[model samples]
Target: MKLYPIESGNFKLDGGAMFGVVPKTIWNRTNPADANNQIDMAARCLLIEDGKKLILIDTGMGNKQSDKFFGYYAMWGDHSIDKSLAKYGFNRDDITDVFLTHLHFDHVGGAIQWNKDRTGYETAFKNAHFWTNDNHWEWATQPNAREKASFLTENIMPMQESGQLKFIERPQGDFKENSELGFGILFADGHTEKQMLPHLKFMGKTFVYMADLLPTAGHIPLPYVMGYDTRPLLTIDEKAKFLNAAADNNYHLILGHDAHNEIITVQHTEKGVRLKDVLTWSDVLTGY
Candidate 1:
């Protein structure tokens, strides 16, 4: 199996919101903020070429939202799913499965796009079967007011409407070994209800897709939860348990939202589990 890091695009988000109650004085040292207080963010997706199936982890926020709508999140960079796919001599049509970690716009927006005439929305990966768990599918479709804006109908309903949506059997416990998608899944709820963090076995090692569970390395600290999360206290506990296991097993974290830091490996530190190393995509392909 071959794994590729697909660069969907980059944008900026409020550092304050990204790091929750963690004061800027602290987080700014790690993730510097701009004059307007926004920090660089990347919607990096992962592509898995395993035999006949070409599975894409997340699609990133696509370029379909209106300029006015996108104005909120200051976007940057020329990277797109098309360009990234082309870099690997592939295209959207080649994707057979789209495994969404969650239904947040940044994670699943690129799964659907405008039709040829721009009349309505349609599946971005025409040949792909979009995957989300039953619990998350229900949580996203019937979103609470707090997360409604992030779960846009245009970015979501089209997949189901197009008859391409599928649900994984929600695991009875926090971790499931070798899910239907052929990888272990670590379920996290502090960030959002039933956010599935894929535990992929790559390079003969464990690589966990750090979705909202650990947005960036800056959030490695237990208390630095996101303001958008509905359950901050729960997030702290969830993060502690996950981080401990990640450190114990030497799991490589593939970050989804960090613009600068790509891959991270944590180790036990005096303070707590801290960043052991930051690796670039090239570093990942070549060696440790």
Candidate 2:
């Protein structure tokens, strides 16, 4: 199996919102903010070439939203989903599966795109089976007040409408119990209900997609939770548990929104699981 780091693009978000109650003095050290107090974050996605299946982990925010809507996020950078795929000698049509970590606009926006004539939406990856959980589908489709803005119908409805949407097996227990994914799926509720974090076993190393659960290395500390998370206290508990397990097992965590750090490992320290080592995707995947 081969893995490719597909950078969708970059966008700006309020640093305070991204780091929750964590003081600016702390998070700003790593993710320095602009004059407007917005931090630049990468909408990084992953592509997996496994046998006959070409699976893409999260699609970045597509260029379909109106200028007024996009004015809020301040999208930047030249790395687009198409350019990244072409860099790896592939195209959207080559993707066989689109495994969405969640239905948030930034994560799944690139999953659908405007049609040729711009009449309506269509599946971005025409050949891929867009994967999302049944429960998440319902939650996103009928979103609550706090999350309604993040779950855009334009980005989601088209996948199902195109007949390319499929749900991974979900059982009685936590979603992970029933997740016999090619890699593995770690269900995290602190950020959003049943956000799927893909764990990949590659090159004798475990590479985990640290979705919004751990957006960046700066969030390694238990208390550096995102204000957007519905359950902040629960996030604390979840982070502690996951960080410990990640440290103990020496897993390589791939950050979802980190613009710099790609992969890192944690070690047990006096303060907690502090970052032990940092490496790039090439280093871990191809030993470059």
Candidate 3:
């Protein structure tokens, strides 16, 4: 199996919101903020190539939003999914599966695109089956007031409308090992209800896709949870548990929103789980 990092684009978000109640004095050290107090973020997606199935994890924010919407997010950079795919000699049509960690706009926006005539929306990966779990599907479709803004209908809806949406059947436990995808699935409710983090066995190592649960290496500490999470207290507990497991098993974490760093590993320290090493996708490839 081969894994590729696809950078969809870069955007800026309020550092305060990203780091939650964590003081700016602390998080700013790792993710320095701009003059506007915003920090750089990436809509980095992962592509998994195995056999004839080309699976893409998390489509970054697509370019379909209006200028006003883009203005709010401070979207920047020339990187795009098309160019990134071309870099690997592939295209959107080659993707057979789109595994969404969650339905937030930044994570799932690129899953759907505007049709040729601009009349309506269509699945971005025409040949792909958009994969998300039943619980998250409902949570996003009928979003609560707090998360309603992040779950844009334009970014979703079209996948199901196109008859290409496939919901992953939740097995009879809190976590289910998906043999078909060659990964184990862990459900995290702290960030959002039933956010599926994939524990992929690749290159003789275990790699966990740390969606919003652990947005960046700076969030390695238990208290550095995002303010956007509905349940901050629950996030603390969830993070601690995940970090302990990661440190004990030496799991490499694939970050979704970290603009500068692609992968990281943690170690148990006196203060708690702390960043052990920061690595690029190339480092993993070369090691393999």
Candidate 4:
């Protein structure tokens, strides 16, 4: 099995929103905000090449939204989905599965794209089976007031409409048993209902897709939950449990939004599970 870090692009978000009640004095040390008070975030996705399947974890914000809508996020950087795929000698059609962590615009936006002549939407990965949980599919389709803005129909419905949407049934307990898709799934509800973090066992090592549950290394602390989360208190509990498991198992955590740190391992430090060592995906996977 081979894994590639596919960087779609970077965008700016309000630092305060990204780091909940965590004071700017603290988070700013790592993720500094611009004059407009927005911190830079990478729309990093993961690609897995396991035998016949080429699975993509998430698609970064696609270039389909109107300029007015995009102005709010201030998208930046040159890295794009196409460019990233080409770096590995592949393209959109090469993807066999698109495992979405959730339906948030940034996470799934690049799953669909505008058709030629710009009349309607189309699946970005013509051959991929887009995977999302049934509960999340329902929740995103009928979003609550707080999260409605993030669940854009243009970025979602097309996958189902194209007859390529699939879901993993909700797990009965804290963790699902025998739920490995060549990579295991870890469900966390604090960020959003049924956000599936993929735990990949590669080369006898475990690498986890941190997703929004741990957006960056700066979010390693239990209290650094994002304000955008629907359930902040629950997030605290979830983080404590997941981080403990990651440390205990010596898992390599791949951050979803950390622009600098791609992969990191945590240790039982004087200040909780502090980052032990930082490495890139290639460095860890290929022994570079």
**How well does each candidate superpose onto the true structure, as a TM-score?**
0.98, 0.96, 0.97, 0.97
Model 4, residue 129: distance off in Å is: 0.6
Tens-place lDDT per residue, model 2, 159-200, is 999999999776455435323347778787888888888888
lDDT of all predictions = 0.91, 0.89, 0.90, 0.90
Candidates ranked by TM-score:
1, 3, 4, 2
Least well predicted 10-residue stretch by lDDT in candidate 4: 174-183
Residue-by-residue lDDT tens digits, candidate 3, 1-288? 888899999999999999988899999999999999999998888989988889899999898988998898898889999999999999999999999999999999899888999998988999988889999999999999999999999888988888999888897866898866777888889889899998888888999888999998788888888999988899898888889999999999999889999999999999888999889988998993
Residue 256 displacement in candidate 3 (angstroms): 1.1
- Determine which window of 10 residues in candidate 3 has minimal summed lDDT: 173-182
User: Cα lDDT of model 2 overall?
Assistant: 0.89
**Candidate 1 wrong stretches, greater than 4 Å:** none
Q: In every candidate, how many clashes are there? A: 0, 0, 0, 0
